[model samples]
Every structure is written in C-alpha cells, then in structure tokens.
Target: MKLAIQTSSGDYALGLIDGTGQLVNAISRAPDTAAAKNIGTLYSALMQKAGKETSALTGVMVDLGPGGLSSTRAGVSFANALSYGANLTLTGVSALEATMLDAKRKTDRPILAMRPSPGGACFWAYYEAGHSVASGCEAPDQLFSRLATEGKAFALAGPLRRIGTEALRATAAEQIDIPAADLACFAKTTPILPITNGTLTYLEPITNMDGAHHIAAKDLAS
Candidate 1:
C-alpha cells in the first residue's frame, strides 16, 4: 500500500492508501516542534490504525509546499528520512495541484489556488481547461488586477482563499474558497510520479522575514 504524509499545514498528517486511492487509515496531529516532534506520534497512530508495519509500505507521498517554511522543511525532512529507513520510493506533490484537484470537484470553472506567501502576497497557480496556465507568487491586488483585466472567471482554493477572494471581490472578479478537507480528498485521488530514491529537492524558502520568523516561532513551540 502507498503511504502518504502531508505537512503543508499546522498539522502533520499520515495515511495509507491502496492502489485504488482508498485511504485505509489517516491520522493528523500538530507537531510540538519544527524538528518533527510529533511526527513519530502521528506515524505510530497511523500504523496502529492501519494494522500494518512500516516495512510493508510500497510507496511514499509527501507534500512539497509553498507554506510555512520551517514546518514545510521539517515535514519534508521527516518524510525523506522515513522513506530511506523503509526503503520505499518517494513522491513529491505540489500543494497547489492538490488544492486545484479538490476545487475541481465543486466546479469546472478555471481554478486559482492561492497559498499565503511570506511577502504579503500569495503563491498562486491558475488551472484552466484542466491544465496549468500560470503559477507564481504575487500580491493579491496584483493578481486580482490582472484577472479583472483579463475577465477571468476563476474560483480560488488553498490557504490564502480569504485574502484572494477579498481582493478579487474588490476588483469584481468571481472567486471562492476550497476547504482544506476537500484539498486532502483531491490529494488522495491524484497520481504522482515517485521521486528517485535518495534524491532530495529543497523548496524555495519564504521570502518574508517577519512571516518566516513568525512561522519559526510556531515551529519551535510545536
């Protein structure tokens, strides 16, 4: 069975999924520190729930994010180590893609997934006709301005939904927030290519110093 770990949010989530995308057991818990303090606990819970040993894992999936810097790094690090320890292949999935997949279930309209960025902007990806059109980080105003000029009817999904929606509304653009659970649901269904064994890819760190510091504090607390 495929094992999945998502640490893109405040909580660390672990689950097992069969070939058909059926989630066997999923558990989530907040970390006590950025160094994967509660990751062990979550894994243990998942193992108990699934009634399986870690050595039996077929593949591992992890969320590579545009979220809290320290937490993201901690999560990715933990996943990397776990995959190595278990001798399992690993896959890295984009948080944005997961959000879009979740939003698509609600509407076929163009989707714009937005995650809070350190720069007081939002990391965004635009998916139209089931294909990615654009992906980048930009201020909500700038993004909404462009969408307004283009007259795009896109729904917003991800952590920055409120920020994106409010900005879009100010510019008279249509937008909606996709729930977190929906995003997780979409992730469970999507197929991802596994990363080469032993390969490590680091994501871009948050650019906002204050935001990074804030997340760092949270990470330390957790």
Candidate 2:
C-alpha cells in the first residue's frame, strides 16, 4: 500500500492506495474530522480504519505545490520526516500536473492549468499532446492576454477556476476542478526520488516571476 497526502490549498486529505494504485480508503476535511494539527494521530486512525499498519506502506506520495505557503511547507515537512524515518520511497506531485491530469479526463484538447498564488500572481502550465510544453508563474493579466493572442483553445483545470473572471472562462473550451483524489492516482506513475530531493513547489511573489524557474524540492528545506 501507499500513503498519499494533499495539503495544498489549505485543505488536508489522506488516501491509502493499494499496489495497483487503486484507492482503498481516504479521509478528507470535507467529510472527515478536522484533524490538521494532529496528522500523526489522524494517520494512525486512518490506518486502523483500513486494517493496515505503516509497515505495509511501500512509499509516501505528496502534492508539491504552488499553494498555501505555510500549509504546503508543513505537509512536505511531515512527509519528508515520515518517509525518511520509515525508510520508504518519496514521490512528489506538482499542482500543475494535478490540474493537467484532471483536465485530460474531460477533454483531449490542450490543457492550461493555473493555480492562484499570493500577490496577484498565478502558477500556470500549458500542456499539448499529453506533455507539458511550458510552465511558470506570472500575473494573470499578462498571462491571459498572452494566451489569448495565441488563439489556441484550451481546456482549463485547477483551483483558479473558482476565483477567475468571466473573460478567463470564455477563453477555455471547458474548465474543471482538480479532483479530490488527484495525488492518489497521479502518484502511481510519478517517479520516486531520494528524501533529499523531496521538495515542495514554492511560488514567490509576482515581482520575481521574471526570473523564476521550477524551484527544486531541496531548496525549501533551507
């Protein structure tokens, strides 16, 4: 079994998946008890409910994000400690990839996945032919206008849809929400990396987007 954690966006979720990547059980704040502060306790409860133990887990999967800065840091920190102490593999999933995978289920068109960030910036990724073509963080005003000028229709998926403008909606073929169990499924294929490389995606302020690159997971520890 594998353990999946998604705490990006300030909402917490834990999922248990089998070797085949099938979700065996899950707990989320939306339907479960509010247990964010006591994740270790919650994890124990989840394992008990699933009739399993930590020894059964093969790895840990986490959503590395352009998300709530403090929350993302907390989640990744916990995941890193758990995987290291337990001698288990650690896999990281990006917010862009989660949105892209969710959008692909609804349409075959190219996907534009966006996650809103602090200071009026957004983390965006463009995918074509099932591969990521470009990704970066930028102000929505400039990003949307540049995309519009390209004249290519895209299916949109990500947290941005909840707070985006009508003009943003009009630019997409369709928009969909990121699935609640996104990391659980995406984790199956995502490569495992050393605990040293298990870093979270950190989105800096819009002022720094001009020089931004995909930040490494290790950088966040410093």
Candidate 3:
C-alpha cells in the first residue's frame, strides 16, 4: 500500500503500488487548473478503486522537483497533508533521480534526465557507475557544450522530451527519450526510502530554490 504522486508535467499522476510493486490503482489527468486543485478528486478516485480509506495507506511517496515549482509544491503539500491525516510515513524522491532510476534499469548505458527550468534553462542529472549525479542548470547551448566534452551515450526522460525533437536536436546531444512506464518500473525497485514516520520529523521541506545549484557534484564524479 505505497501511494505515489507525481505532478511534474501538465498532467497529474496518482497511484498505489502494492508491497510487491504491482500497481493496484492508478489515475492520470490533465487538470485545467493547477495540480493542487485536483488533489482531492484524484485521492478520492484512488481510494474508491482500492476499496480502502486513506488511513489504510502504509506510506506515501512524492516526486519533489526539478520541475514546475508551483506543481511540485502543490503535490508535496497534498501528500504531506494526506500523510499527516492518514498517519502514513512520508518519502521525498527527486523527480530526476526517479527518472534516471527508471532509465538505468532498462539499459546499461549512462543516463541523463532533463526537465525544463523556470527560466528557460534545463534541469539535468546523470546516472552512471551506479551513482546518481546532479548537473546544475544550463541553457541549451551550455548543456550541449558540456555533453560534447563528456562524450557519453545517454538516454533522456521526463517532460523535456516532449519539448519536441527539434529542441533536442538543437542540443546536439545524442540521447533517447524514455517512457513514463519505465519510470514507474524503476520506482518499484529503488523506491524512495521514508525519511519520516508520518510525523513532524518526516516532513523535510525543500526551502531553497537554488539548492540544486549547491547539490555536490562529488557524489556523481566518476
């Protein structure tokens, strides 16, 4: 009874993954308003499908950003509130990390997960040598420039892929876009571990907007 929520894209996703990693019930919708507005509806629908109450959920997981700020906040807020109300543990996983985790399971090649940033820059991260690495913000040109120096075969995932082939071509980085199903599968194996036991301690808020810039590159330095 692990509940997962992801609102990284325009569409919102809600699902319950059983202990065995099987999808018990899932729903996705492109809401007219912000993702926050549809939280209640999505939660209700999932509960109905599962034939259980929110209180019955064992743990809750949320895809914390590298995506839309408002959407990420909304999803995290909703997940936090629900976890508090239902007495479930909370785990915050990076959306990019999850994307790469999904990609790595599918191929042995290095992975590069990209998402659009607020300022027309890109949120990029790399997974290689069994470590997830965060690369700071980069304009289209900077990203490609760095990729040229790295010269690694990589796969891409997330909403940025939908930015169109022309946009990807503009980067001149050799890569492939992965599907969401792949991400969902990756979540099952290396799922975000709970940081809190459904209590005050479990709510680790990511307050700094510039935190990604400070994400140490040492972990991913290979």
Task: Report the poorest 10 consecutive residues by lDDT, candidate 1.
Answer: 213-222
- Residue 153 displacement in candidate 2 (angstroms): 1.2
Per-residue lDDT for 1-222 in model 2, tens only? 889877776467788978777888987663234566667766887898898988999988777676766666666777787887887777776666766776777788888777777777777767787676677776767777777776777777787555476567666556776634265555534443433334532222112223333432111112
Question: By summed lDDT, which 10 consecutive residues of candidate 3 come out lowest?
Answer: 212-221
lDDT of residue 102 for candidate 3: 63
Indicate the worst ten consecutive residues by lDDT in candidate 2.
213-222
Highest TM-score: which candidate? 2
Per TM-score, what order, best first?
Answer: 2, 3, 1
Computed on alpha carbons, the lDDT of every model, listed in order, comes to 0.65, 0.66, 0.65
Candidate 2 scores a C-alpha RMSD against the true structure in Å of: 6.2
* TM-score, model 1 to reference: 0.78
Query: Model 2 off-target regions past 4 Å?
Result: 30-34, 170-172, 179-181, 195-222
> lDDT tens digits, residues 1-222, model 3?
878887666667888878877777887777575533778888888788789887678988887766767777788888888887777877776766767676666677777777777666776767675466556566645666666677656766656555453547665444556434332552443444445455364433343324632255332335
Error of 1 at 201 (Å): 8.8
Residue 207 of model 2, lDDT score: 21
